[model samples]
Target: SAMFRDYLSRFSLNPKQKFKTLSRGMKMKLGLAAALSHDAKLLLLDEPTSGLDPVMRDEILDILRDYITAENKTVFFSTHITTDLERIADYIVYIFKGRIIYSGLKDELLEKYCIIRGGEDDLLKIDRNILIGCRKHYGGFEAMIDIESIGGLPSGVVTEKVTLDDIMIFMNRKGENSCF
Candidate 1:
C-alpha cells in the first residue's frame, strides 16, 4: 500500500517482515503508517518514543511535528519523557495518582514556578511557607518556590528557571500541606 511504501521509504523496514519478528521500532512505524492513512482528526499515542534509539526517536518526532502543523491534526500523547513535551506540547496536563494536579499552558506553568539557590545564610531570608520544597546543605541551599510567593528577599539569592523534570521532582518532594 502507498501508506506502507511512504513509511518504508523513510524508516527502512521490510514490508514483508513477519509482524512477530519485527523490531519494536518497526512495529511502531507500521502502526503510525496505518494511523496516518486514515482520516482521523485526533491521534492518541502512548510513549511513542519510548525504547527507541535517538535517531528513530528524532524521525518519529519529525513526522509528528509535520503532521500536527501541516495536517492540523491534534495529538494527545502521554510520555514520561518530559523533554518530548517541551518540544511539541502546547498545553500540559499533569496527573498523579488519579488526580489532575495541573492543566494549563506549558509556558505559563514554567513561568509561575522556579528553583531558588543561594548560600546557607539565605535560608533565613526565605519564608518557609513560600517554599514548596527545600534542601539545606552545609554551604548552599536550593528550594522550589512559585514566583508570586517570592516576597522581598535581598538581591543575592538567584532564581533558576525550572524544567518539566525539575517540576515533577519538586512536586514529588512537596508535602501533603502543599498549596498545589
Candidate 2:
C-alpha cells in the first residue's frame, strides 16, 4: 500500500479515481502505480507515454529516471518517441521487421553512424559501399554511413549526427541490399 501511495504521489494521481473516467495520463499513472506497488525491480513498458501531453510525457520520463538512478532498478522501455529514447535509454536495440539490426550502448551507436549529404557528384566521388543506406532526392543525396567510413567520403559533402529516428528511416529504405 505504501508503494502504491508513493508512486501515486509522484504522478499526482488520486487513489479513488475510476479507471475509465480518468484522462490518458492519469490512466498511465495508475498503471505504473499498480506495476510498481509490488516492489517491482524490473519494468517492461511498451509505449508508456503514448497519448499523453508533452508535460505528462516528460513527467513520466522524470519518474522513470528517478526510478532507474535513485532506486537502481531497470526499465525495459519501448516507445516510438525518439526524443524519449534519447532521454531515457542508455542502450538501444533496433529491430527492423523481425531482425535485430543494431544492439548496444546508445551513445556508441550514435557515435558510430552519421548522415552525409551532397549532390550526385558527391555520390560519384565516394564509395557507395560505405553507405549503410542511401537516398537520392531531386536535388542531391543523403546517406547513412559509419563514422569509420568518413575518410572514404569526399571533402565537400556535409555530414551530420544521426539520431535513432534517422537510422530507423534509413534502415527502412535500405531494402534487400542492406549492409547488415
Candidate 3:
C-alpha cells in the first residue's frame, strides 16, 4: 500500500502527504501492479485494460507478464479488445452470449482463420463448409475461413490476412431484432 501511495503522490500537490487524488492511468497501473504483488496464485480479470491509454495499458500488461512467469501462477482474463491478447495471451478463448465458440492456442487461430474477399458471384463459388463467418463489403464479401481452404475459394477473390478483432465482429453479429 505504501508503494501505491508513493506512486499516487507523484501527481499530487502535497508530495509527502497522502490524499485520494490520482489520475485514472496512475490508479489503474498501481492497482494492477499491487494486485500482482499480492502473490495470488490465480488472477481473474475482466477487461482490465479497458479505457486505459496505450502506454499505461502496456505498463500494466508488463506487470501481468512478470506475475504470470512465477511458478504455479496463472492469469485468466476476458476482453473484446484483441490487440492486448496479441501482446499477452499464450492462448485465446472466444466466447459469445456465454457460449464458448472457440478455444485454442493463439498461433492456431492466427494460422487458421483468414479473410477472403471477393465479389458476390465469386463468393458463391467457395465451399460452404470453409466459411465460418462473413461481413458484407460495398461490392463484395469478406469471409472468415481456414487458410488451407483458400484453394476452395473462387479464383477471382483475394484472400487477405485478418486480426482477431475481425473474427470477433463476425462472431458477435446478430440478425435483425436479436437486440432488445
Query: TM-score per candidate, in order?
Result: 0.89, 0.91, 0.77
lDDT assessment of candidate 1:
0.82
The TM-score, computed over Cα atoms with residue i paired to residue i, of candidate 1 is 0.89
What range of 10 consecutive residues in model 1 has the weakest lDDT sum? Answer: 171-180
lDDT of 2 by residue, 112-133 (tens): 8899999878778877677777
lDDT of 1 at 164: 91
Ranking the candidates on TM-score from highest down gives 2, 1, 3
Q: Once model 3 is optimally superposed onto the true structure by TM-score, how far is the C-alpha of residue 67 displaced, in angstroms?
A: 2.8
Per-residue error at 56 for model 2, in Å? 1.3
lDDT of 2 at 118: 90
- The alpha-carbon deviation from the true structure for residue 72 of candidate 3, after best TM-score superposition, in angstroms, is 6.5
lDDT-best of 1 and 3: 1
Give me the displacement of residue 101 in model 3, in angstroms. Answer: 1.1
RMSD of 1: 2.8
> What C-alpha lDDT, on a 0 to 100 scale, does residue 160 get in candidate 3?
78
